[model samples]
Target chain A: MSGTDKILLVDDEADFVSALSERIAHRGLAVDVADNGLKALDLAGQNAYDAVILDLAMPEMDGIETLKRLLDLNPDLQVILLTGRATLQQGVEAMKLGAMDVLEKPARLDLLLDKIRKAQANRVLLVEKRNEEKIRKIVDNKAW
Target chain B: MPWSPDPRWRDSDLAFFGAVTAGATHELNNVFSIIEQTAGLLEDWCADPEADVPAGCDKILNVTERIARQVQRGTELVRRLNGFAHSADEPCCNQEMNDLLENLLALMERFAAQRRVRLVFEPAGAPVTLTTRPFILEQAVFLAVSAALAGTAAQGIVTVQLTGGGAGVEITITGAPALPEAELPAAVGAWLGPPLWNLEGRVRTAARAGKYAIVLTIPKISEEVP
Candidate 1:
């Protein structure tokens, strides 16, 4: 399952998450499932995932908290929050908390996949930019 | 001039609007998600050209067309919800009774579906137009329909009829449990009365032939009342 399309899926609803993961896996994309935010955090820490499909409402740790922790561990990680019912306030809060974007649950798989692909592309760009900065700083120090 | 604004009701109205709109968007999100997954599956199949191209491509195309159909359904739902939100923009305006029923009913469909109630609207005559507070009128209609849905038996039908009556068009919601005037909530009667009165209309809840009906009479206004 370790491939360019590797992704983490976190949701408490066993049936929904399992079904969605199966569908995503059928698309030739690698999927790792986590039933709760804490487990998602643990997985994020141990393994490398390009993007995380996270649910907002959870038992202990909510999506926002999980999002902050995942990003803290890997700043380049793309997190998309899945909401059952979206209110105007929740959208703003999600963005402020450093979420890539929020998609309502049972979101069109095509759209969700598009967002994931975009997230992967963005992570690559950020990594490349950071490397460029680091190389420039090293070259400057050597010149000095 | 007859209509007076109640600052308290505004909160309740806003809350109701938020709830209905939230429910609509939530449902739409699920709809879009399903279509997205369907399209993704097609893309996966198309990415692999090694399979039997002619036969496999034909099956993939069928799924692709299904995605297009879902897009159409999602578009209509968004358009109807947009119209519903706009009904609250103006304090008072000229509105078509059927259009109002259509818009409001579309918003309430998910809620009604949960209770297993069917909402149907019958246009009694031509398009009936009246000058009134659109949002207030919508709230009145919403309450009446909700009550009917709540009071009726499971798998019941609430029929809303739009017809010309005494001074203006009469919007009748029938097929709910009947309640006498004494049984009516004084707060409801008090709250819904002023807006209709200001619009030169009236709302009456009466029992006829064993079933209860909420009759809203709106008198046509030739000039703006402000």
Candidate 2:
């Protein structure tokens, strides 16, 4: 498994989550499933997933709240939101909250796969930048 | 008292109209999402090897059927919504009771289903056509239904029965209680003003078999809009 290609699929619909994860797995990517936001947070904390595919509406924690918590736990994590009933205002609000993107439901699998690959690349870049900053700081401190 | 426009009532009515449209659009969005996912699945199955995917074509066929069904449902909803929007285009127009209520009820199906209430429409006789302010009259009836729903038990039935006689149409709503006399003023406030009163010849409430009933008598519009 390419470490950066792992994804967490969070949605209340069990069948939809199963079908979608199967598609993602068929594409040669590792996927974890979470039926609700609470379970999603658990999976995120336990594994280093490259991104999350989250549904906007749920029973306990809605997409916006879950998105907030997910980013708080991993500032660099990429999150793509899915919504069956999305409005322009909701999309704008989600973007302002640092989501990688908002995709209306029944998103094309190929397009979603493409987005996942892009998110994986962006995460790798962020990690490399952070590592470079840390190394430079260490060298400067040592010299001082 | 002379007729005067009530801004608050207008605002609330507009808000109700907005909610109705929003509900229809949300349903369409879900339909589109299902179609997208199904088509994507079909493509995935088709892309794989024919030998390994004997059922691929069959699955695509099934998905296409499902998509067609969704499109039909979405089209019907859009058509009903279009009918409702046009109901307001003119101040006064001729309306058939059955046709008007069917479209309005289609728009209201979600609200009723959400509350687990079964809506029943009973036409006593032949189609009754009346000339009136179609939108206002429909709004008044819809609000009465909403009011009755407030007192209705979940899974209970709300019946809108239509009858015609002597140059007028009588709509009797039974199942849930009518808005109390004290609250009727606010519920029908602006819509029941002088101009509307002329359209609704009579309004009253009565109890039938321990169930509340609200009756609205609609008079035929005398003059056509120029």
Candidate 3:
């Protein structure tokens, strides 16, 4: 992926988040970390990220709820659910709520990077499609 | 065994065991994941050709410290899991209420966290020994705490206070967004009924303004006298 691909890593585990963020940052990606769903939403609202790495289980608002709200803010946002105790039901629920993918805890770094690359590409395509529609509307409204 | 040999009890016991084990194992997994990432970062720093020697050494020290802390956490979790597994060794045994409750709260910490509820235990300051079926007693306490957690709202606190006297011991579990008086019986019954019966324990529920408290009174020396 490009060094400009920025991602948000959300989890309640402080050490885990810090370590993972460092590893991701080391690979030349701009990474932001949030310790809870609320903080994550705040960051997501304020900034644009190529992808979001979210934890499934959190204190108040879980990943599923976060995923819903994140999509509500920007439908094109790509979220990957990473959890320590993931179940099939939870995976389905996340996917149904617009999550790009579900990954279990202690995930392989290479696999996560691959997903992030895909997310960045998907995001670019979505933004381009939305922009194209806007230009088409402008052209239709203009005088000949 | 003084308690009934009903199949339902067996099922309850197994379910509790399974839930606790699964939660603890999940916690251990997180600990391992942190250690793995921290170590990996350290390795990355070492492999970088243009790495800043002094800065890299400092970062390496921090990562090693992080790994050590997580290892200590993992060790503590395993110790508690081991203690929980042995609680069912005998039908009845002498147990210290404070230690037992501490172990239980640790096991249930994840359950409380998932709901954004805090579980606080106030020890009696002295060991309260009771000759009882440890497993049943733990189940009863667990049920009481579970009921309190259900009634509490997000970011609420469920406090378990232990008080022991010459006669017996009292465990008061209180939570906020209290249930109404009428609903208390049903809520408490669903969780504490069978286990409380086996412990020869009596439960008294009270509403304190906006909080509800369930106080479990058990004789210091169980009538079973095993």
Q: How many clashes (backbone N, Cα, C below 3 Å) per candidate?
A: 9, 0, 0
Off by over 4 Å in 2: A1-81, A88-102, A105-144, B1-17, B50-52, B56-58, B114-116, B148-156, B176-198, B201-214
Best DockQ goes to which candidate? 3
- Give fnat, all candidates: 0.30, 0.26, 0.85
Error of 2 at A81 (Å): 5.0
Native-referenced Cα lDDT, model 2: 0.75
TM-score of each: 0.57, 0.63, 0.89
lDDT of 3 by residue, B164-222 (tens): 85467899998875345457755665567677777778898887678788899877544
Write one digit per residue (lDDT tens) for candidate 2, span A1-144.
Answer: 234668999987654665678678778788999988889999999999888999887655778999999999999989999877567888898899999999987677878888898889888888888999999999999996
Local accuracy of candidate 2 as per-residue lDDT tens digits, B1-226: 1112223434476766776787678667666766666566666776876434574577556657877877897799899999999998988877788888878877876666545678888875777777888887777677666656655667689899989853778888887443344443344444444435747566676655557776788888787656
Model 1 complex DockQ against the native: 0.14
Q: Which pairs clash inside model 1? A: A107-B33, A108-B32, A108-B33, A108-B36, A108-B37, A109-B36, A109-B37, A110-B36, A110-B37
* Rank by TM-score (best first): 3, 2, 1
Q: Please, what are the lDDT tens digits per residue for candidate 1 over residues B1-226?
A: 1111233443477766876787688667756665766665555556768544467667766666767776887898899899998988888777777788888888887666655678888875677677767787887777667666655655678899888833478888887552343344343456566566656677777765667777877777555646
Candidates 2 and 3, the one with greater TM-score: 3
User: Cα miss at B48, model 2 (Å)?
Assistant: 1.8
